[model samples]
Every structure is written in structure tokens, then in C-alpha cells.
Target chain A: MAHDTIIAALKAKFAELVTTEFRDNFRVVVAPARLFDVLQSLKDEHGFNMLFELTAADYLKYPKATDRFGVVYGLLNMATGVRIFVKTWLNEPDLTLPSAFPLWKGADWLEREVYDMYGILFDGHPDLRRILMPEAFTSFPLRKDYPLRGRGERHNFAVITRAES
Target chain B: MPLEALPTLPEGPEKDYLWTLNFGPQHPATHTTLRLILTLDGETVVTAVPDIGFLHSGFEKLGEDLDFNQYVTIVDRMNYISPIMNEIAWHHTVEKLMGIELTPRCKYIRTILGELARISDHLLCAGAQALDLGAFTAFLYGFQQREVIYDIYETISGQRFHPSYTRVGGLLFDVTDQFIRKVRNFVKEFPKTHADMCRLLNRNRIFLERTQGIGVLSKELAIDLSCTGPLARSSGVVRDLRKDEPYLAYPDFQTAFKVVCAAEGDCYARYIVRMEEMIESLKIIDAAIENLPAGAVNVDVESKAVFPAQTSVYRSIESMIQHFELVMPNRQWTPPVDEVYGAIESPNGELGFYIVSDGTGVAYRARTRPPSYIHFAVFPYLIEGHQISDVVAVLGSLNIIAAELDR
Candidate 1:
């Protein structure tokens, strides 16, 4: 299968950096430190040309969890139309992961969004500012600890009037 | 927060001539609520930083609280221009997560409706682009045809805007003969308006001058920024999910129509690509209608995935129990504990849902990868060297709806 070849290639190249498995397609688990290297290899060597999606998931109460947060990287090989997910977990005190901006320019906003939602820091990102939320906002809304209704953040905004303008 | 946070222009010899100009969150050029902090030297835009989230409603958070079927309503607001496509995309993901294969009739009906959504979406994009460029007549022509498409939607779903028609394994109801006739009439009549709009703008001297080379996005940059749909196709990235990864009944009509692409990678290229796509959509709709099979619109009510019919629920205890089990919050259907990312070729681009289920009716995490969000991010790069007046032309061509962009 196509996944088998990808797994074999990843295993042969970055055996120490990542652990590969099959879920949906091929899924690779990389340590936070080795994430960039693994992603670079996948893009440069394996022809994973497109970064389909880059998102983060909070696993605070997950049954199977080694870390509190997981950063998922969805990569696509446009020629073969095969997709693989590369994920890395961030522990309690250190919630930072390497940025994939160098590999794919698409990572600029995707990483910024992850930083916005989960408070997960992306080291070496050019602009790691809040994208969806306002600049003054402090809370990370997507984290498990964050409340759904929000902690009075919505009510804090001062509505401007025509007189003020 | 004060305006103190605004970054001042770098002090240099040229800094005296450069000034910051604000474009929308209110202006018509943006098409929707979007703010752009544009730095311009005279009329040339030095940089354009898109400020979004004016319409962010946190749909992803709502997705976590709602069940698979219940969340369909939330996605309906994601892309308000063509709400049915969002509903279909959301349910398509849920069905895939639960490993539910739709009936042949359901698949065929979904394909037809999905193509219709694409036509309406492209029509609005093309019409709005022309409208922004002062071609008001072409916009009127395109919108008139869009109204007919909406009429067909109203006939089938009853609600024109937010038609929550697609269910997990099937459609809400079977199409009536009248609905089929209206759609047939729409496909037959839509081409005239489509052709008229093409003639009005495609070769017009003024339209060509304004759009031909404005906002040119290279194929590499398009892929680097993860652009899709017409935006990517116009830039020579030949990736179409319908052709590459066929879902529903798309594979059935692979040769009926070809994917439209242009190598120019400009606003005109995008406009032409969208215009050509409407024709392809009409072709797909015609094929689907001709080969429409006779069967049940939905799967068996006994399957528990869908609610039981009112007649059955009133007459039998078994059906009544099934309805209560489905409608009750505590006893709703539970998907297996797993994570899956399902994507579809939305009119905008690749609209994908990344779902994490915890073996409950509700989701652990539901993330929507909106195409507009990614496409809008590349705005600063695309408009960097262009004239300020050309901004609206490019913005209209991108067709970034604020609800989808910020959501």
C-alpha cells in the first residue's frame, strides 16, 4: 500500500526521531524537539508538498495521554493524493514546539491560530500573535480548562458609539 | 485597548511619503466584515495585513457541546452564501467517522445538490467581483440566475438559506417531481445568463486592464499558502478533490466535465475559472438528474442513526422508542472513540472537519479547517506590490466571507 511505503521510508530515515503507525493513513509521532527535522525530511524527500492543515488538540482528560496538548500536522502528497498526520505532544511546563513555517509558508497563520487557541508556543515563529482573538485578550479559549461561555471576556469589550467616532 | 499598540512606520527617507490606510470592517470592497491595515506609498500598497474575527462566533466550541447530527445546524452558518454545502460537508465527516455508507439514491441526490451549491457560490463570487469593478449589469445578470437556483433550494428544503437537508446516512426527504422540473429548468436557463456575464467582462477592455495582471499569485505561493478551489486552480495547481479523491457520485461522471484551470494566476484568471466552473456544475447537475435512481431518500428508520417517521412513531411502540432514544439527550447515538479528518471540495476550497470523538454523542474536539481562513492569510503577500485601487478587485476575486474567515 502507499502508506506502507511512506512508513517504511520514514522508519528507515528518521528511525530515532519518530514512531510510525497506521491510523486513517500513516500517522507519525515525533517528539517536540525532533518535529522540525521530521517535517523537513517528509517535505524535501518524501514529496509531501502541501501542509493540508495544522491544528492543536487539548488532551487534558484523554484516557491515553502522555502530554497535556498535542500539535497535529496534516501533510499531503499532491501527486499521489495521500495524506499523513504527524503529531507531537507538549508537556505541562514546556508548552512549546518547533515551527513548520520554514517548510511550508502556510504554517504562518496555522501556527498563529494554534498559539491563539491553546496557548501552545511555537518557537522561532516570525509573528506568534493572536489571530482570531483581539491583541489585548489573555485567555486561551480552546484549552480544556477554558470555559465554553468564556470568563467574561466577551462582555469586557467597550462598544463604541457614533459620538466617540 | 488604545491605538498605542499600532506599529508605527519605520523612520527612513521614504517614510515621509508612506502612510497607513485602513480598508474595511465596513467598506464594500472587502465583500464582508474584514479590516485591512494597508501601508501605501501614494497608491501602491506596500503591505496589507488582514485583521479578521469581526464575525467569529466560536462554532468549534459549539461543535464540542452538540451531537454529530445536532452540529449540522452550526456549520450551516459557516459559509452563509451556500449553507447546504456546509451541511453536506459536516455530515459527510460524521458519516465517515461512524463508517456509514449512504444509499445510492442519497449519494446521487447529494451530488446534484452539492453541484448546485457550487454553482450558486461561484455565481455570487463572479457577480460580486464584477460589481466591485463597476460592471453592475453583469452582477445583476449573475444574481438573477442565483435567485432561480435558490428557488430550487426552497422547493426541496423549504428553507432557501439554511437548508439542513443532508442527514448522516441520507437526505431529509425525497425530491418531488416539481423540484426536479424546477432544477431542470434552472440548468437549461442558467447558461444564457452565464454566457452573457462572460461576454460582458471576459474580453471587455476595461475589465481586462483592471484584472489581467493584478494580484498575480504564483503557483508555488498558492500551494505554500494552501490556497484551493478557483484560487489554486487559477494559479496552475491542478488539484481538485472531486477528480483526485471522488466522494459521493462524483466518480460516476468523471468524464462528463473537466476541471477548469488557468495559468495566469491573476484576478481575471480566477474570475474566468469561476465562470467556467459554473458551466461544469450545470453539466454535473444534468447528468445526476438524468441518471436519478428510484429508491428511499433516507436509510431505514430502524437503523437508529436517523429519527423515525411521524406516522411510524405514532402507530408503533418500537418506532416510538427509537424516536425517543434519538431525540433524548441522554440516549442519543454514540460514535466510536476515534479521530478522523474528512474533507470535501467546497465552493470556496477544501472544507475539512477534524473530529475527535470520546464514544459519546458529543465530540471531544471538532475543528473546522475553513478555506477562507488560509486564503485570507496570503492576502498581505498577494497585494504587497499592487496599486491600492486594485485591492478591491483582488479582494472580491478571493471572495472571503467574514463568517467563514473568522469562524
Candidate 2:
């Protein structure tokens, strides 16, 4: 069945928001500039209260990729059990986008994870530092270009001998 | 009142006395591998900063390198307490991506195992919660039953810990009648131990003192923070993916079970919710075993996503060729070049897998929405204004599996 209510609400409320074909759930693609506004609207008006998941997909090597990274925001309306994906594409070099932390408090760690893995920077994130990776590590491991077997940086750490301490 | 609303120490000479205490990447109460920097004013916590990623094995990055089948082994370590749930969640998403339907027997068998995994996980959480609260006997009561569930898993998959039995289309092997008989016996006898645990802890004054009104999370905060499964249910969020989304064979056992909840949202309430959930899981397992269908467990032979039987390979050339192609790299099925997000109601919460496919056996990007990763964030909010001792209570209540965080 076509999810006309949500589409109508989005079109009626925010005419500029671009929504794509409904697949597994309602999929919306909005510009990076309008992300904060759209997310706020979804949270306040549409009752998509929970930003349950936030992750970026590195589509650099994929033939069908339109952008270098696709940051997927998995939204859910708690009462209704409705889910939607709000996606914003970011190209290489300047991997900057508006952070959803201000909208949903749960987005704090998620945005940090996206930044840690994909090297995507979130603007206005309070503490957007490395979450899963070390703060000193330079390269983003989840990026398509990054090697699976990391570049032997661990070998540099001095091995602790019995007498070293 | 929720713990966060309590008065913070206003600025003055008193601010200098605020003790900065490091609570475990190795400490006992933390259950290891999760560190929390607690700013304390005497016994009451002022602000808590979480530092995780100690067990960071790079599982998600491994997903891209490992094809669909190889990835199951990685998911096992993510939520190591209940690996079968991870396996089911992984294959469930993969099947959704591949548009493969499981047979009736496969569905029923998965439902039984999934509920068993839920019970097994809840038992650990309950045991750990009691163990952390100084109730050693209660811990043993719940923990000993977990071994029986492990025995059940071993009967099916030949492994006690990380079964990794689930495959993309069906399973590693079809469960025998012996497996069904074992499951039947488990559900029958599990409740006696369940009652013993409930009688020991539910009314015990010390257990109530340690847990009740401690680590309180409000219903609004619970929903806003996207907490699910027992954590949200304990806070009166009343949202369970099993009831609402109804993936697997949960809908079939609708009359037999329910979404357990509690209004308290404290450590005690979380424990109670878990305790009640185990019973509900037993009800699901019992109902499923009773009405278990008799048929081939795997999908039709035409489906390429599943591993073929060895005898079938010996009997037919097509089976041998299919097995060879599936085992070999870059010679197997090609799923659609699309993205799909699918989640199951794991023992903790909404354990989800988001797979972005490039129309290859290997996923372009495989991300997991681990419940622990998000639930751990709520800790700083919950533990503030509560005593340092309540930290363990809160952490145990949330069941923050540290292995899930790094992924």
C-alpha cells in the first residue's frame, strides 16, 4: 500500500523536502542544508521521535553510487511503529553534514560513530570525536579505500617485555 | 523522579571537592570493557562520561570483506551472550534483501531457537544483575538454567557458545526430532527454576532496596532516547518489535505470549521485565513445539543462497556444482543492488542490520544498530544524581553488552 499520509504531511508541511520511492519503508532524500529543519519537523510534527540508527555507507567503489557516502538516518514513530529512512549524500573531501544530535539526544553516539568510521564531519556536534577508533588514528577504516587489514600501524607499538615495566 | 532532575552541586568552594572517579574498563561492577568517568560530589554522582571501544574488533569493517555466510561468525562475537539471535537477525536481513521465504518448519524451528536465545540472554542479565547486587545465590539459580539452554543449542548446532547455525536462506543443517524433544523438555522444566529465582529475588528486601527507585528512566526519556526491548518496556514505552513488527513466527504465538512491561523503569523494574519476559519466551517455545510442522526445513533446492546437503551433492551433479559454486568466492548468488534495514526484537532490544548491497555476495556496507551502543549513552543521564553504587545497578539493568559497542 502507498504511504500517502506521511507523503502528504511532508509535502503539505515542508514542500521542499524530496522523498523517493517507498521501498522497505518510507525513504526520503533531502539536501544537507535542509537536513536539520526536516529532521526537526519529523520529530515535532510527524511524531518520528526516535532516531534509532544513524550510519554512513561508503559507496565509492559501487558502480551505481551517486555519491561517495550515503548517511542513512533510520527514524521510527514510537507509538505507531512506523519507520522511515532520511538519507543525505555527501561527496568525498568535504564530508560535512548537519548533526541530528540537537534533534534526538540518541543521535549523539551515532553521529560520532559515523564520523569515526566514514570520516564524515557533523556540524554542531558537541563532541564529534572518534568513538570506535583511537583519537590519533588518521584514516577512516570504513571507507572503501581503507584496507581491511589495517596498514601495519599496530606493529609500531613497543612490545612490553617482562623487564620493560 | 528520574535521577537527572535531582539538584546539581551549584558553583562555590564545594566544587573543588567534587571527586573524579574512573569506573572501569576493568572494574568489577562494570562487568568489564566499558569505562565511565564519574564526577562525584561525595557519594552522589554529578556527571558521568562514558569511554568505550575497548573490545573494538572492527566487526562491521569485517562484514564487507566477508561474504554473507562468513559474516555470521563475526556477528557471533558482537552480542556474545546470545549469538544465535545475532545469527538469526543477520540471516533475516539477508533473506529480506535476497527476497527468500523460509519454509514452515524453518520458521517454527527458528521461533523456538530465537525464544530460547532470548531466555538464555535474559537469564544472564538477571544473573549478572543479582551478582552485581551481592545476591550470589540468585545469580546461580538463573545462571544454571542458562547452561540447559546451552545444552539445547549444543544439541542443534554442536556448539554451546556461538552456534552460528543460521545461513542466508535457511540454516546450516535441518534440526532432527531429537532437537524438538530436547526443546520440549526444556520448556517444561524451565519454569521450576524460574519460580525459584522469582521467589528468591522478587520479594527479597535487600534486592528491592538495591534496585527499586534506583537508575530511574522516565517514559518520555525512554521513548525519546530510542531505547527498546526491556529497557523501554520497563519505562512504560510499551514498544516491542515482536508485537509491533512481528518478524519470524512471533505472530503465530500471539495468544500464548505478551510484551512484558513495568512502570518503574528502575533496575528492579528492568530485572522484573526480563524475569517476566523469560516466562513469555517459554510460553512461545512451548506453543511453537506443540504445533511444530513436519516438512523439509530448508527452502527448495532451486534456491542458491543456502548450502546444499552432502548426500544430495553425491547423488546429483547439479547439487555438487551448486555446492562448489556457493563455497567458492565470486561464483555464488547476486542479490539486488539496494539497501535494506531489518531488525528483530533481540533479548536486549531492537537488534537491526542495515545492508547496502552493490549486487554482489559481499555487502558494500553492513552496519548494525546495536542496542548496547545506544543504551549505554543513556547511562550518563540515568546515573547522574544517584549514588556511585547505583551505577552498577543501572548498567546491569540496561544489560550493556560491551562487545556490541565496538561494532
Candidate 3:
């Protein structure tokens, strides 16, 4: 069947997915349950070859937010010059989603970054470790509830003066 | 042990089969703030684990707190070599999110500065790579070119190193006639330096031997690993965002525009790609400077969210208030709660910003898809089967900026 746009083709392929457009970008909001399948299909079938970026946002304090987290996947079809954001949401007590590393090896570090910042877990990821923060860090700094100044984590480090050294 | 002969690899017990070497968080070759844990079987690397994030200042976190104009200062430090490029990319994303249209003059001016930044950044990367490979004179040659470029930046932004020169709707200030003359002079004089530096390294047998087959990244792996810019171009990717995306004034470049590519996906190919790209950038700057559009450099934006240039503030009373509003760091405009991902072909690669707004001037979430961050990840793969010395070649070829990686 012929489709007008990639969004239409995707919508026809997946029944549960909803598509929204913002500033010429087609954002496909997919459910967390079938994210891996959707991403794999997008790569293999739809030619969305590049997983350009993967990140998550905390909507814990958002006025109209329905979910606690919004994981965004920046994808690009280099051949067609069509770019998209494959979005999926997760709530508190269950902030886990399927990893896109299988589709793109580049997702390795990006997923780790998302994990470090927002404390979101990526299922089936080979090495999902804290990327930008210390491994011992207990809190996710990017979440809205996390204070800008940090919660005494900065003060916890032992101070060593130049005179002592 | 024989005193006269070179030491040989010891044939020893189990532990000798695989040895781990810690390379940098402070090592000279790493350019500092980037650490690598290498699992070595004798001299051949079995694996290279990049332990990074020494300079993680939470740039994304700061983006949520700082207003649009205030944020440029922070982004300026992300890619310090091409600080102006970061400013341009930040505002490019900001303007796209806020639906602000730039003036014709503003676009041309930004394009000129962006290309200048590309040349400046490539010079440093090529210089530092040569410096790592022990070609000191070539490094000096590249640095001399950079010093001239820095003078141009210093003249425009009032700060040499971190020129937070770009503002939301336009620039911090309009370019002076002297600034235009300096850029023109740089364009005229840079070729001799470039040719000299190329001669110093390109044909030098030792440099060629060290870099030719070292750290070969296949074109497939380049794409799969999300490598961009010269790294991908060198690997025969045939992709340049200038032609593909055509942001700024790249599409209107008067000179013969072409994406420089190489069939060989090695350190040598990457070197050649950067060398060719610097020439392309100079051509772009020449075209832009000659045919710069005549108009107000700042967009005639009425929105309180966008700031006017210093020239506008001096001439108009209304613009003066807008300047203070931007400077004071107050939330002045209500934008529709939406998200946008805007990117530009920066010197390093596809420098992009994914911004989410929550009906306020401050970003709800600001995510940076920096090139260095991905290139750093791809380092281990490129160096897996190479010798210890090849690590420097691969790492240098990648040009992973430490600040951008952690941020």
C-alpha cells in the first residue's frame, strides 16, 4: 500500500502509536511495552537508520503531564532526509524500557547517559552504567524534583587543601 | 637481561597474557580530562575502556535554570576550540524553538563566523594530532594560524578564548569595519600556512607510516557508531550536513561546493579530510564576506524573549528595555509548550540541541547531542586491534573534546 508520509506508514503499521508534529518534526509517541519492536521495525523496515540521540525528561512537576518520564529517541532516515523523535513514557516505580543498542551501536553511551541523568533503566543493554556522574551517585540530577544546587552531594566529598598536599 | 639489545616480551605465566594499562584523566596524549583503561595483550590492545566525565559540569542541568541569553555563556564552554560555533548552534536551536526568523544580514554574518570557527577548530585538531605524533614543527604551524583566528575572535567578542558572542535573535554586537578587514586578511593569509602545515606532515614518511593504516574505521562502523563530520567523511560516508541540511548560508556559497570524502577509513584519510575541509571553510568565508547582505544585523523581533544587539540598544529606546530584560535573566515571554530539535553542522560534527519548553522562557529539558560524546564512545572500537602507539593516532583523529563528552 502507498503511504503519503512516513508518519502515515508508521501509523498504519502500528495501531497503538500516536503521531504529533512540532515545528516540522514528526514525534511518534509509542508505548513502552513494544518500544524495541517499534524501533527495530523503524530501522529495518522504514529506513530510520540512525539513532542520532536518546534521552529522557522528568515531568514530575509538569502541570499537564500524565507520566513521570518521557524518553525521547532522535532518529534520522539519511536516505530520505526525514528526521523524527520516537517518544515513549514511563512512570514512577517502573522506569524501564527496551534498549535500542541492537538497532544502533551508538545507543550504548547515549542510553548510559539517560540512565545516569534520569535513573531510567534500559533492558537488555550490555553495559548500562552511569556515564556523566559518579557510579556511587544515588540520585538522578536531571529530574525536576532534584534541586539545582544538589542535595548535599557536593558537600559529601572530602576537602583537601593545597597546604595539606 | 642483555644490556646491548632491545628488551623482548617476557614469556611468563597466566597474568602476563592480558595486562591492563591506565591512560589518562591526566596523561598528556589524552589532552586531559579523558581517561582510558586499556586491556593489552602485550602491545596489541584487546580492548580500550573509555572512563570519561572528569569535566562534567551538568551543562544540560544548567540549561534548565538559565534563560536563553544566559545559557549561551555555558554552551560557549562546551566546545571551547570553536566557542562561537556552540553559541551559533545554541541560538539556532533557541530561535527554531521560539519560531524567530533571523534577518538576511544576520544569517550571512552567522555563516561567516561559523565557517571561521570550523577552520579554527580543524586547525587545532590537526595541530594537536600532529603534536601527539611528535611532529612539533607542524603543530606550531597550525597554532600560528589559530593565533591569527583568535585575534579575529578577540576583536569581535571582546574575549579571546570564550567569546560568548551570539545572542538569541542576532549577535552580541554588529561586526565593525575593522573586524571585516581582519577576516578578509585572515582569508588571504591562511592558505600559505595551511600549505606549509600540509607539506610538513602529509609527505613526511614517519608521519605517513604512523597514521596510514592505524585505527582504520570502516565506513559501516562509522555510520553504525554514529560518527559524523570528518570522521565519517574520511570513512567514505559521503554525508555532509552543509549540503544535506543546508542551514545558515551554506546553500548559497558562491564557490564550487562539494563534500570532501576519502575512500580510506584510516587516520591518514581523516587528516586529509580535515585539511580539505579547512580550505572549503575559507572559501565559504570569502563568499560570505564579499556578498554580506546590507540590513540590520539583529532581527526586528518584538518579542521580549529575544534580545537586541548593542547597536540597536544604542539607537532605539524600546530596544534598550529589551536588552535589559534579556540581561536581567527574567522570564519575559510565554511560548507554546512544545519541543524542537534543531541542529547545525558544527566543526566537530552534528551539534544539536533538543529543547522542551513548558510555557516559560526557561527550558523544561535541554539535551545536547554533541559529536564528541559519540566519537569518544567509538574510540574503544577503533583502537581494539591496534598497537599502543596507534591509540594516540586514533584518539587524535577522533578529536574528542573532553568538555563536550561529559556534558
Interface DockQ per candidate? 0.57, 0.56, 0.54
Question: Which runs of model 3 end up more than 4 angstroms from their true locations?
Answer: A1-4, A161-164, B1-16, B301-305, B308-330
TM-score of chain A, every prediction, order shown: 0.89, 0.90, 0.92
> What is candidate 2's fraction of native contacts?
0.71
> Can you write out model 3's per-residue Cα lDDT over A1-165, one digit (the tens) per residue?
122467787778888988888776778899999888788888998887788888888888776889999999988876776788889999989988988888899999999998989889999898877777876788989988889999988788778999998
- Measured with C-alpha atoms, the lDDT of residue B120 in candidate 2 is 87
lDDT of 2 by residue, A1-165 (tens): 335687778778677777774246578888787888888888888889988989888888988567888888989987677888888888867789988877888989988888888889999998878877776788988888889989997676977898987
> Candidate 1: which docking quality band?
medium
lDDT of 2 by residue, B222-337 (tens): 87787988999999988888888888888787788988989988999999999999998888988899999888778987878776788999999999999988888877779987
Which 10 consecutive residues of model 2 chain B have the lowest summed lDDT? B1-10
- Point to the candidate with the largest DockQ: 1
* Local lDDT at B26 for model 2: 94
List model 3 lDDT by residue over B1-407, tens digit each. Answer: 01122123346786567877788888888976898887788899888788877999889999999888789999999998899999999899888988888888889989988988999899989999999999898888888988888898899888988888888788878889988999999999999999999889989999899999888888888888888889989998877888888877777873445789998999999999999999988888888899888888777756565566568899999888876766664546566798889999999889999898887778888889999999888888889889999999888888889899888
Q: In angstroms, give how far residue A14 of model 2 lies from its true place.
A: 4.8
Displacement of the residue B349 alpha carbon in candidate 1, Å: 0.9
Better model by DockQ: candidate 2 vs candidate 3? 2
